[model samples]
Target: MKSISSADKLEDQKFNALRLRQLTETNPSIRAEFGESGDNVAMLIDAISRADALSKSQHIWYIDMIEKRYDDLAENEIDDIDTSDKDLKRLHDDLRENLIATITSVSIHSDNIKKSIAETPDAVQLLVNAMHYRGREELRTTAVVAIRTLCSLDSNKILFAKAEKIFKYLTRMFDFRDGLVLKAAFGTILSLWSFLDDTESNSVFTIEPSVKAHVIKGIIKLIEARCFLDDVLEFLARLSIHDDATEKMVMYDATTCLFYVLRKNPSLHTKENCAVILHAICCKKDHRTLIEMRSEEKSRRTLSRLVEGGTPRAIIKVNGILERLKE
Candidate 1:
């Protein structure tokens, strides 16, 4: 009998890694065996760690695997891919999605799992990179959802792991027109901002004026598409207070669209945010003409109805806009 060499053992491990990826996805029993809900989390993390070691990249193994295959297939540009290639692609997607699902599930389960995930070499970084990669909306959504959960505890460990990259990745998330991903992106960014220490918060998000315009306009595009996320409106209410951001908001007609949603969405959260944004733009003298022409003239009846119907904050903001229109 020939002795097994280290190379043989390595190949065996890699082979098992690939097989493990599929088994957990295709077999319900295996998936449950590795799920986060019970005692299997430790083994699950170990499996992911082994897979990441095999990948030997900044991203998770399955993501790297599928993206490479996708790149190869995309380059060919053939009308029909070979059957083997399609099967392999499906296998990679299943593994990638299931592993990401595990990561997301484990993130929300327990503080211990959160800490363990963070402790896993490059786990948090890989999750962030998954969001950064292009053309995979579901991948981005799941990874960011996990990030939101991990960051919920506000552990400096997670934030400090390539924190600048994480910030940039999330800012890019706003540019995605897919409303579902954008909504998840908004909630994730809110989590980061809600807890970031002042120094990091100021530094990480302080983009150039053009970049700020791009982000604001991106959100406006979503409103035009009628995505109308309350988190987005809430974010805008906070951000538009800054003079330059408010300027971009006016340039992009955010005030009018916000009013459109305000009249349309009866949710108190929506009402207050729209009121706040309209009021902020109203406060700026340079843009009041734009506000008057674009939003106020169209807003009085809606604002009047809101004055009698909304929360105190919304009412105050509505009254302020009406008072401006009067003057």
Candidate 2:
């Protein structure tokens, strides 16, 4: 018999990696054998690591494996690895890093993967911890993406609203200089703000008074750039659900921001959100006339465009706000 060469061993590992991906996809029983709740988590991590260096197809399979692992872990009771156990901790970190990478990658199943992470009690906290202390931009970006994805669901939004520490960490990320990082942070904040509509005491989205002013300032600063214009508008629009938030948007010259964005031909969503913010600003007794006279023509024109070209929901919102303006 011929002796097996190192190349042969490497090929075998890659082949095994591909088969593992296939089996995991086709057979949940086999998949559970390598789940995060089982003893095979280390083996899964090892396979993922080896798969990453293989062909593009294998790398994608690795991402799928990571996503499935996250889903499986989400269904089981969470148990943190002992930090004192160096080997276990290393494996934990590796698994988490791979998870972040997979979350950031392109995939049609991203929403399902995100929901899985959101379902996991410790998963959001783990990502937050990594973002707060990891110092790596890529990891931080991934964490923000993961958080944003979680916020996409109403159930997850309520859950996140109760996670004060996660929101606090996300607020701090707004101060980061990286543009991509800033955008991701903004998206996460917007998601958190969506929780504001919840009336339940546990569902209230809280921004401590101490950080409120800082957050307002950070948002306005980000709005100065054209790239973040729509994001800022949408954030303010959602934020306007509270009168105080509307006041802050006006104080930050949001009218001016809206005027420019509308003129530049923003998307229907942006236009609709801008109308909401404007409507909210106009609803305030003190600020109403001032904003009305300041940009009356521009606002009307923007509303017309939205009415003509917006989505059914956007059309309804803008039309109602317009009637209110007319009154």
Clashes of each: 0, 0
lDDT of 1 by residue, 131-236 (tens): 7655357767767777776766656333533454665677677767776677666666566554543445557534456656756776677676666567678878
**Top of the candidates by TM-score:** 1
All models, RMSD in angstroms: 7.4, 14.0
> Whole-model Cα lDDT per candidate?
0.62, 0.57
lDDT of 1: 0.62
Error of 2 at 53 (Å): 29
Ten contiguous residues with the weakest lDDT in model 1: 1-10
Cα lDDT tens digits, model 2, 1-327, are 011112255434434444444555566565443342322333333333333333234435545755666556643332331222333333334434444444333111445444554555455555566567533465566667766656776667766666646656786787677887887787776666655645535745556644454466567667666648766877767677876776776666666666667667778787778777766766774455455534656645766777788778777766776676665
Worst 10 residues of 2 by lDDT: 1-10
TM-scores, each model vs. reference:
0.63, 0.50
